[model samples]
Target chain A: MHGKKLALKITSYCFLCLFSLFFLFPFVVMFLRSFFTATESLAIGSGLIPKVFYPKSYLDALDPDFLKYTGNTVIVIIANVVGKPLTAAMAAYAFVKVRFKGRKLIFYTAMCTIMLPAILTMIPVYKIFVDLGWNNTLLPLTVPAFFGGGFLNIFLTMQFIRSLPKDMDEAAIIDGANILQLMFRITFPLIMPVIVLVAVQSFFGAWNDFMGPLTYITDERLLTIPVGIYNKFFTAVSPLEAQPNVQMATGVIIMIPPIIIFCLFQKQLVDGVTFTGLKA
Target chain B: MNKNTKYKDILKTGKTLAALKSNITGYLLILPLLIGLIIFTIYPLLLSLYNSFYLDYDGFNNYSEFEFGFGNYIKAFSGYESKLFFKSVGITFSYAVIMVPLGLVLSFAVALFLNQKIRGMVVFRLIYYIPCLIPSIVNAIVFGYIFNSEDYGLMNTFFASIGIPAREFFYSASSEAVVTFAVMSLFGVGGAMLIWLAGLKSIPQSYYEAATLEGSGYFTQLFKITVPLCTPYIFYQLITSVIGTIQICDQVYVLTSEGGRDYSLLFYGVYIYREFQRNNFGYSAALAYMLFIVIAILSAILFRFNKYVYYEGDN
Candidate 1:
C-alpha cells in the first residue's frame, strides 16, 4: 500500500510537469522567437532556443505608430473597463435590489442578450455605428460596453448582492442615508472584492477585444495592438515582408500588461472567480 | 386628541411619499444602460429577427422601408444555400464537441497540480496563463510558423529526427496535419486553467479533511469531492469553451494555407469570414445568426442542468 501510494505521487508529479510544459511551451516559443534577430530568426527557424538574444525586435515594435496603437488600446480598454461594469453593476443592483413594476421583464430582456451571441447584431450595429460616422473612432469599441450588461459579471454581482443581508438597508434608512449613500458607503464596501473582480475581468475583456476593434477601427493611426500585429503578420494573399520576430515582439508587448495585472492580483483573481456559494 | 391624531396621519403620508421618490431615483441611475442597450443591442437583435424574415434587395440602403416577410427564413433552410447552412452548423457543433471537453479536462489537470502546496507555484501559474493574454492572431501566427509545411516547420524537423518523414502539417490537415490541429487547441488551455484554479480553491477544506479522516486516498477524494463541488466552474468553462470553439475561425484563418488544401481544418467562423472577405455580408450575417441560434438553444437546454448542479450546503 505504501509503495502504491508512492507510485501515485510520482505519477501525479510527472503528469503535472508534462502538462505544465505543454501549457508553457507556446509562450516560451513566443518569448524565444522575440529575442532572435531577423536573419538569425529566419535561419534558426522555430527552434526551442535562440542562437543569439537579439533585442532589435523590441525596438522595431516601439515605433511611433506602435505607441499610437498602444494608446489606442489603452483608450479603448479604459472606456470599456469604466463603462461596462458600471453599466452592469448599476443594472444588476437595480434589478436585484430595487422594487418596481416591470422590473422582472426588463431584467429578463437584459439577461436574454447574453445567449443571443454578438454575431446576430454585427451587421446592424456596425451599420448604425457607420451612420453615426463613429466607425473609425474608438467609439465603436467603448460605446456598446457602456450600454450592455456583462451577463457574467452582473450575475456575479447579483449573487454577491443577494448574499448580503438586506437589513443593512433598513439600518441605513434609520440613519437617514439615501440610495446613493446606500450603494457607495454601505453596499459597495461590502462587495469590494466582487467589484474588483468585475473590474479586472472587464479590463481583460476590453484589452483583449479584437473583433470589435478590427471591424470598426480602420484607420492605420487608430489601430490597437491586435490589429497592428495582425497587419504586420499577414498580407493574406500576398506575403509582404513578414517579420516573425517583430510580430512576436508585438505579441509579447501586448501580452505584458495583462500578465502583470494577472500576477499582481493572482490570489484575488483565483479566489474571486471561485464559485463561493454557486450551484454546482 | 383628535387634532393630534390627524397631524400624525399627515406625517405618516409624507414619509410614504419620500420612499416612492427614492424608487424613481433608482430608475434614473440605470437609465443610461437601458438607452444604450435599446439603440445598439436591443434594436439590432430585433432587426436581425426582422431581416431574417425578409431579403432586402437594398437592406443596407433602405432598411427602414423594407417590408417584413418570412421568405428569407424559409429560404435559409430550403434555399440554394441551405446545404451550406447545415454544413456550417455541423462544422460548428463538431468543433464545439472536441474543444469544450478537451479544454475542461486539460484545465482541470493543470489547476489540480497548481493548487498543490508546492514551490514555484506562482511561476507556473503565471506561465500557464500567458497564452490566454496573447492575441489569438499571434498564437495562430507563431503556430503557423512551427507548422509551416515544405520541411521548414519545427514539426517536420522534430519528426525527421525521430526517423519519421517530413509531413505537411499545415497545407492540408489530412492525416498529416491532425497533430497541428491538436497543438492549436492546446495553446488555449491557459484561460480554462485560471478559472479552474479558482474552482479548486473554492472546494472547501472540509471535504478533503473529512475524506482524510475517513482514510480515503487522494484520488477518491478528488473524484468524489473535488470534482462534484467544482461543477459550477466546470459548467462555466464548458459553456464558454463551446461558445469560443463554435466561432473558431481566427486561428485557422491566420495560420493555415489560404486554400487550406482539402479544407479539413476550415471551421465555421472561418467560413463566414471567407464569405465576408468575398463581399458576402448578407450570407455572413445569415451564417452568424445560425451560430447565434445554436448558442442560444444550447444555453437554454443547459439551463435545465440546474437540477443536477450541486449548490453548497443545500443538502
Candidate 2:
C-alpha cells in the first residue's frame, strides 16, 4: 500500500510539472527572444537564449508613438479603476441596504442584461457617441465607467455586500446617518476588500479593452496600446520591419503592468475569482 | 376618545412618511446606475430593434426618410450576404460546440489535480493561472509568433527537432485556423481551472472519508461524489463560456489579416462588425439581434437542463 501511494504521488507530481512547462514555455520563449538580436531571433538554430543581451530591441520598440499610446492607456486605466468600483459599490449599497419599492424588479433587470451581448449595443451606442461629439477621444472609453461601470461589477459588489453583517448598517441608520453617508462612510470602508477586488478587475479590464478603443477612437493620436499595436504590427501583410525581436520586446513591455498588478494583488484576485464563481 | 384617535392618525402619517423617505433615498442612491441603464442599455436595445427593420440611414439623426419594414432581415436571409452570413454562423456554432465542452472537461481535470493534498500546490495553481494575466491581444500576438507556419516559428522549430513537418496554424491560407484557435485557447484554461478548483474545494472531505471506509477507490469517490456535486458549477461555467466562445471576435481579428484566408475564420461577430464598418447600420443591427436571439435560446435550453444539477443541502 505504501509503495502504491508513493508511485501515485510521483505520477501526480510528474504530470503537474509537465503541465506547468506547457503553461510557462511560451512566456519563457517570449522573454528569451525579446533579448535576442534581430538576426539571432530569426535564426532557428541560434539557440533558445540570446547570444548577447540586446538592449536595442527594447529601445526600438519603445518609439515616441508607443510611449504616447501607453500614456493614453494609463488615462483609461485610472478612469475605469477609480470610477467602476465607486459607482458599482454605491449601486450595490442601494440594492442591499436601502428600502425601496420595485427593487427586486430593477435588480433583476440589471442582472438579466448580462445575457445580452455588448455587440447588440455597438451600433446605436456608436451613433450616440458620435452625436455627442465624443468620438476620436478617450471619453468613449472612459465616461461610461463613471455611470455604473459594467453590470457584472455591480452584481459582484452586490454579492459581496450581501455577505456582510446587516447590524452595522442598521446602527448607522439608527444614529441618523443618511443613505449616502451610510453607503460612503459606514459600508464602503467595511467592504474595502470587495471594492479593491472590483478596482483591480476593472484595472485589468480597462487595460485589455481593445475593441472599445478600436471602434470609437479613429484618431491615431488617441489610440490605446493594444489598438496601436494591432495597427502598427498586425494589420499589414508583413509585420512592421519584420523584426520579430522588436515585436517581442514590445510584447514584453505591454505585459509588464498586468504582471506587476497580478504579483501585488495575487491573493485578493484569487479569492475574488473564487468568491465570484462559488457565490454566483 | 377623540384625543386617542388624533394620536393614532399622527403615528400612521409618520409611518407613511418614513416609507416615502426610504423610497426616494433608494432611487437617489442608485441614480447613476439607473441613468446608465436607461441610456446605455435600454435606449440602445430599443433603437437596435427598431433599426433592424429600416434602411438608408445616413445617420441616426434621420431614419424617417428611409425605406422601412423587414428589408434588412430579408437581405440577411436571401442574397449574396446570406451565404456569407450563414457560413459565419456555422463557424461560430461549431467553434462554441467544440470549445465549451473541451474547456470544461480539461479545466475540471486540472482542478482535480490542483486540489490534491500536496506541497507546492498553491505555487502550481499560480503558475497555471499566470497565462490568464496577460492581455488577450498580447497572447494572440505571442501565440501567432509561436504558431507561425515557418520553420523558425516555435512550434515548427520544436516539431522539426523531433522530425515532424511544420503545420500551418492561423496562416492566411490555412484551413486549420479554427483548430489552431482552439489550441491557442487552451493556454487560458487557467481561468476555468480556478473556478473548478473552487467547486472542488466545496466538496466535503468527509464524503471521501466515508467512501474510503467503505473500501472505495479514488476514482470511485471522484465519480460518485465529486463529479455529481460539481455539476452545478459545471452548468454555470457551461452557460457563461458558451456565450463567450460564440461571441469570439477580438482574438480572430488580431490574429488574422482580415478574417483569415478564404474567410475560414470569419465568425458571426466579425461579420456583424464588418457590416457595421461598411455603414450598414440596419443590416448590422439585424445581425446583432439575431445573435441576441441565438444566445437567449441557447441559455433557455441550458437552463432547462438545470434539473440534473445537484445543489448541496437541497432535498
Candidate 3:
C-alpha cells in the first residue's frame, strides 16, 4: 500500500510538471523571440533564445504611431476601469440594500443581458454611434461603462454584497445615513475587494477589446492598441512586418501591463471569477 | 374607541408613505443602469428584430428606404446568398460541438489534477492560468506564429524534433482548420479549470470521508460524488462555452487572411461582420437573430438536464 501511494504521488507530480511546461511554452517562446534580431527571427532552425541579446527591437516597435495608439488605449482603459466599478457597485447596492417594489424584476432583467450576446447588438449600436457622430472617437467605446458597465460586473458585485452582513446597513441607517450615503460610505468601502476585482477585469477587457474598437474607431489615429496591432500586421503593408522581432516586441509590450496586474491581484481575480461561475 | 381606531389608521398611512418614499429612492438609485439597458441593450435588440425583416440599404455606401417584411430573412434562407449563411451555420455548429465538450473535459481533468495535495500548488495554478491573462488578440497572434505552417514554426519545429512530420494547421483544408481552432481554444482552458477547482473545493470533505468509509476507491468516489456534485459547474461551462464558441471571431480573424482558403474558416461571427461591412444591415440583423435563437434553444435544452445535477441542502 505504501509503495502504491508513493508511485501515485510520483506520477501526479510528473503529469503536472509536463502540463505546466506545455502551458508555459508559447509564452516562453514569445518572450525569448522578442529579443531576437530581425535576421535571427526569420532564420530557419534558429534556437528559441536569441544568439545575440538585442534591445533595439523594443525601440523599433514603439514608434510614434504605436505611442499614439497606446495613449488612446490608456484613455479608454482608465475610463472603463474607473467607471465600470463605480456604476456596477451602485447598481449592485440598489439591488442588495434598497427596499423597492419590482426589484427582483429589474435585477433579473439586467442579469438576462448576459445571455444577450454582443454580436446581436453590434450593428445597431454601431449605427447609433455613427448617427450620434461618436464613431471614430473613444466615446462609444468608453461611455457605456459609466452607465452600467457589463452585466457580469454588476452581478458579481451584487453577489459579493449579498454575502455581507445586513447589520452594517441597519447600523448606518440608525446613524441617520441616507440611502446614497449608506451605499457610498459604508457598503462601498466594505466591498472594496470585489471593486478591485472589477477594476482589474475591466482594465483587461478594455485593453484587449477588439470588436468594439474595430467597429467604432475608423481612423488610424483613433485606433487602440489591439486594432493598431491588427492593422500593422494584417491590414496595411507596414515595414514592421519584415522585422518579426519588433512585432514580437510590440506584443510583449502590449502584454506586460495585464501580466503585471494579474501577478499583483491574482487572488482577488481568481476568487471573483470562481465566485461568478460557482455562485451564478 | 373611535378615536383610538382613527389614530391607528393615521399611523398605518404614515408607515405606507415611508415605504413609498424608499421605493422611489430605490428606483432612482438604479435609474442610470435602467436607462443604459433600454438604450444599448433592449432598444437595439428590438430594432435588430425589426430590421431583420426589411431591406434598408443598397450596398456599403448607399442608404435606401426600408421595405418592411421578411425579405432579408427570406434572402438569408433561400436566396443566392443563403448558401454562405448555411455554410457558416454548419461550421459554427461543428466548431461548438467539438470545442465545448473538449474544453470541458480537458479543463475538468486539469482541475482534478491540480486539486491533489502538493507543495507549491498555488504557484502551479497561477502558472497554468497565465495563458488566460494574455489578451485575446495577443494570444491569437502568438498562437498564429507558433502554429504557422512553416518549418520554423514552433509547432512544426517541435514535431520535427520528435521525428514527426509537420502539419499545416490554420492554412490547411477545412477539417484541419477545425483541429487548429480546437487547439487554439485549449490554450484558455485555465479559466475553465479555475472554475472547476472552485467547484471541487466547495464539495464538503465529509462526503469523501463517508465514501471512503463505505470502501469506495478514488475513481468510484470521483464518478459517484465529485462528478455528480460538480454537474452544476459543468452545466454552466457547457452553456457558456457553447455560446462563446458559436460566436468565436477574434482568433479566427487574427489567424486567417481573407477568411482562410475558400472561406473555410468563416465563422458565424465573421460572416455577420462581413455582411455588416457590405452594408447589409438587415441581412446581418437576420443572422444575429438566428444566432440568438440557436443559443436560446441550446440553453433551454441544457437546462432540462438540471434534474441530474446534485445540489446540496435541497430536499
Best by TM-score: 2
- Candidate ranking (lDDT, best to worst): 2, 3, 1
Best-matching candidate per DockQ: 2
Q: Rank the candidates by DockQ, best first.
A: 2, 3, 1
Least well predicted 10-residue stretch by lDDT in candidate 3 chain B: B56-65
By lDDT, who's the top model here? 2
Docking class of 3: medium
Which 10 successive residues of model 1 chain B have the least lDDT summed? Answer: B54-63
Q: Candidate 3 on A1-280: residue-level lDDT in tens? A: 8999889989999989999898988788788998999887766678687899998989998999899999999999999999899888888888877789989988888878877768888889888898888996889888988887778888888889988988988988899988878878888899999999999999989888888888888788999998888887666453345477877888888878987898899889877865683543
Taking all chains together, the TM-score of candidate 2 against the true structure is 0.95
Candidate 3: where are CA atoms >4 Å away? A236-242, A277-280, B56-66, B156-167
Q: Per the 3 Å backbone cut-off, how many clashing residue pairs does candidate 2 have? A: 0
**On a 0 to 1 TM-score scale, where does candidate 3 land against the true structure?**
0.94
Which is superior by lDDT, 1 or 3?
3
Please give, for residues A1-280, the per-residue lDDT of candidate 2 as tens digits. 8999999899999999999999988788788888888777777756577889998889989999899999999999999999999888888888887789988987888887888888888778888999888897889989888887677788778888888898987898789988778777877888898888899999888888878987888899999898898888775565435677887888888888887887788778777765573433
lDDT of 1 by residue, A67-98 (tens): 98888888888887788767777877887777
Ranked candidates (TM-score, high to low): 2, 3, 1
Candidate 2 vs candidate 3, lDDT winner: 2
Model-by-model DockQ, in order = 0.52, 0.65, 0.64
Predicted structure 1: lDDT: 0.71
